[model samples]
Target chain A: MALNTGNKIPLYQQIKQNLKQRVKMGVYNEGSSLPSLRVLSKEFGVSPGLVQQAIYGLESEGLLAVQHGKGVRVLEKKSSESVAISFGFIQPYVEYMTFEGQIIHYAEKVFDRRNNFMIPKSSEGMASREREIVEHFVQNGVKGIILWPIDNDPNGEFFQNMSHRIPVVLVDRMVDGADLPSVVLDTHEAGCDVARHILGKLNCRRLLVLMDNLVISTNRDLIQGLSEQASEMGRMMDLTVMHLPITDFIQRLNVGDYSQVNMYIELVERQIREGGYDCIFCPQEEFLESVIIEPDMDKKFPELKLASMTGPMLTRSRKYNEFGVIRWVWDFPQMISSAADILQQWVLRRKRPTENVSIQIKQWQSTE
Target chain B: MALNTGNKIPLYQQIKQNLKQRVKMGVYNEGSSLPSLRVLSKEFGVSPGLVQQAIYGLESEGLLAVQHGKGVRVLEKKSSESVAISFGFIQPYVEYMTFEGQIIHYAEKVFDRRNNFMIPKSSEGMASREREIVEHFVQNGVKGIILWPIDNDPNGEFFQNMSHRIPVVLVDRMVDGADLPSVVLDTHEAGCDVARHILGKLNCRRLLVLMDNLVISTNRDLIQGLSEQASEMGRMMDLTVMHLPITDFIQRLNVGDYSQVNMYIELVERQIREGGYDCIFCPQEEFLESVIIEPDMDKKFPELKLASMTGPMLTRSRKYNEFGVIRWVWDFPQMISSAADILQQWVLRRKRPTENVSIQIKQWQSTE
Candidate 1:
């Protein structure tokens, strides 16, 4: 920290500018201690009083925390220097889910067009990996994190602590109690749209919804939407939302563990056959593949029609793709683009929105 | 017309009220000759001047038309009395397509809640039948008609004529050149969404879009969307949109002509095989049912994938419903409810919107 003190500009003010540059460059990160006043004073060949004045000015700008026994600490870096700052985007899964890559791709395009840069990482479906990746981002001093959280509330504490370090805009899967700004697709409304379709179009009275674990916010929201629609319909619809052992199964599947995939598919098929349901709706694509693979599904359950809500690649099956089950889907192109918009606004504007932005989910159904 | 002359109400006013009641009850319909002016005066025991004044009043209210030689005839029934009046809903097809009944059902529910009534008619997939239905609705003095037009531009002149007679709201299938208020789905955007998904997720450089005749607005919209997406991608994608002779074929299928079904399916199959395409998107369910029914479609074209768009019941094919061909669907419940809202607003307020209300289309896909 060499200051050009021969000029009319005071040594302390020059020192203050140098220190702010260090903060902007993330040389001293949030919650990290800066050099002692005496050390900084010596480094700058200045008096202790001048160094103290420099520190005080930075403090007034809300850039530092002064402590008597300890040293000054750097606060969160949300200042203007954060513009076009490096952002970390953690894809919820390490594995190549269809929309995951698209989310990264679309987000990259938008961020690139604005001359900002984003670094993407994968959680690898592991909470530990998620933690590690996030910590790496923080340590690297990325300006912000646009998080698409994984399920089971594994990183609640980590999210809260991370929020203090930098701005985080969640591409929300509806993590409750996080109290963070999020961009959420209105999955509940999507569920209601499904219910109305099943009742009004398919004329189905008994509806069975098979999906991921209800602990996940998206799954819960879809079920709540269905239940609310049923309630609103008033005796027109009866709904059953069944949650699988998704925590372990999806984890295994994520890691290429397919031994239990058959078991899960069979469980769903048995439920569809014996449950006396008029319609089945699955928002998760995990079981959709195996369940609809049977050649004689329509013949076995003549009265049963299935519906689904998911992203791209779930429409591979022609049995229901061309005819029976309806699907409600949200793609990465809209969702990720929306999240990127919110993230840019939150980071660039230096003011985060308190409310979560709810986007309408699209309805996909085929008619004969 | 019965008149109670001894009452405090004036004789001419009483005659006007009776004639107004006759018009309100549709005793004298649009474009039909009302009772002669002299005949009206003789029957009401009033002067021709009084009857003429009554006619002028009704004419001022836009309820009747008076010609120099011809007697008063009822004009369009788009007046404020059209409030809560019976609205005619004409489905694009006469046969039970899943969404057709649903549109009527949802529309009826909404209309019923407001103490209004609706009479639903099926066009029977015949241009002639569509014209007949509109003429019948007009003759019956239905205050408004919510028209879901048949394809092939068969009803363009009819629609323009009908708009003048009633507050007609077109559930637009992107019918161009028709200057009318419409409630339309944003199918062009939906098409672009499909294009982005194909490029971003499916990673297909060679694209093929197969559907009904491009003369239809919906098909054209979807194709245009795909083209625009390709254009926006700036040579990352090459799109080919092909049309089938859907007019005669769909009409025959509507009336249960399955003689050429296999031929049509084979034609699509040959195109898929010879095209060397990476993915195919079909927005019309009419061809989707025939295209994907080949159980060995994936085996035959192992590298090919498909996408589709339509209303409920087209997802019956479990093949694409589960895995490969993504589906973009719009349901009748939301659509009909929205259309009903517009119709109610148009008729009750005696004002019509010039812009088409575009509802977003939803995407459905499966992942491996």
Candidate 2:
């Protein structure tokens, strides 16, 4: 099968998986030099830069080596002392979904150390394309899969049935009805924490919670947590919930097109003005830094303390408090590493996939 | 090693582990007859009933068989195909600490199905004894260990360095300063849930939470959760904390001699009368069912409603509401199964142990 340009996975990862498979299948022998970069790039219908990146990844992993002025050559194989535990890595684009990309980065490092291999596949955030890739992996005997499932699918039921065939571990967000193992930040808990900090610490009562959509489990949980906190405080009658048109946007916001930023901004601004809201809470990490609520732009809404769930790199260097927001930071590395651990157990013929885990989120401290 | 009667592990389990080791080491060849029950009982210094139970356990796992006239015979061994993932199971006595024993039962069944094995060990509730068993297993090349760490240990630091030498998964309770993987019920969340249920559902303003000890993570989390809820509602001054004498009693209450339970009962009764508390919350599952606040005995305090975290069997067959108590039923099976999953990942030459997980607890429903 040829590479598809519209795939969400980076071009380099796609090529890397293709070449890795051929090497494992014995189509490419040990010590054999691969075709020149120009020839290989042309064959896969990609630029030479992408092919070189793929080759570099292989070289770094000890799968292949690049001698000075020589083509990439296959290295000696690590024998599977037992059956080599293998998994298919499904991800969105690295540039847009940096949190997920970083997780995959750590997972690959861990897999190498464990003497295991993972092949990545992407369909440009298209659920149908992902389904096809999963089918291909299953038919070809890939043992298990680690999926960063896209929330853009209208049906959202494709993943519900995917895990039935092989062990499928989702990262970052849980699907509503799927019995799949997932490693994710507890948005529900984050919501409760944010509510406490804003209401108790900042002395803010009228709060506005912003999220792309409720279909996403993380987004839905955020609302649930916030509502529960208010109800517990005997303030449910005082809680305000604002919704975006499409569901699952909090999860797939980066992958899907959302050109109407001003519309969401205007809606937020209107709610703050009319409701006399003292705080703005957004559990979606992507939206915290996105244009709709940009840092400098937050100055427009004076006296409004902002709250959000943050990724490791998002608020690390920034003076977040001065930007009028406090973050409940999530450990991205933990989510990725945990998913890999779960996949390893299941693929190695363990009886059943483990229960889904919701990682605890911590209030951001200056030390981190 | 001679079997000790003081072990927390059942005598049958101890003997089962002993015989299993001999079989694996070829001390007893495949199709060979094990020593007669009379000889084995005398040699191990155990009762004949215990020896029979041990042999029966082995037979059920396809490791041995009983013959009509001949002695109990060894059966053909199932090849491990891969490294037979092994863990030493350390637990409390099965008779009183029934919840933990049920967890072990399910874990053993999972181990059998996964083609793995676990040896059982216990020092009752003796911390020093537990340390010796852990040291012995570490030296014997056991791949991993699952410990239901006793809270009675003044220095929980014994478990501190255990995972450094090998993977150690703590079940139910987490040691204070130990860098180990653990699967436990989130007592802190249970604290919050209880606070909400008591304050909102029952509309009770004064709540008294009674537990054997605070060093127990569940009990500590319960207090933390309750205080946080009151604080979140801007009522920190109203939150009450009552401390017991022992630090780790919640964890080892059943094992340690707690004949002074009447002192605890008197304190609770006095507090209820003087403080005018309408509700009593106990996160300790064992205490919820034990005599500190007996079901029929609770009638003396006519207006007080009780709450506790429960195991699967504790409240299942009983009429809970009529007893003047509500339960936050915890899924022990989920806790055990999740720990099994975590252990499986660490023992198979994986790079790092996964993060500690706290299983979610749900409120009891009539349907369950």
| Interface RMSD, in order shown | 23.5, 21.8
lDDT of 1 at B82: 31
Q: What is candidate 2's CAPRI-style docking category based on DockQ?
A: incorrect
Q: List the DockQ of the predictions in order.
A: 0.01, 0.01
The deviation in Å at residue A368 for candidate 1 is 13
What tens-digit string does per-residue lDDT give for candidate 2 at A1-368? 24534323356765776676556545578888888988887877788998999888878877898997877778955421212334667765432333433444445445544545455454456767677667666644455788887764442466666565567888887666677788998878877877777776677878877766537677778888888888877777656887764334433443333455556566667787889887777766445544334434557766777777665543221123236367777776688778887886664433356678888988877442
Query: What's the TM-score of chain A alone for every prediction?
Result: 0.67, 0.64
What candidate 2 gets wrong by more than 4 Å, as runs, is A1-368, B1-84, B92-96, B152-165, B236-239, B244-269, B284-303, B315-321
For candidate 2, the per-residue lDDT at A302 reads 64
lDDT tens digits by residue: candidate 1, A25-89 = 56677789998888877776779999999899889878888988888988866541422345667
Model 2: DockQ score? 0.01
CA displacement after TM-score superposition, residue A161 of candidate 2 (Å)? 46
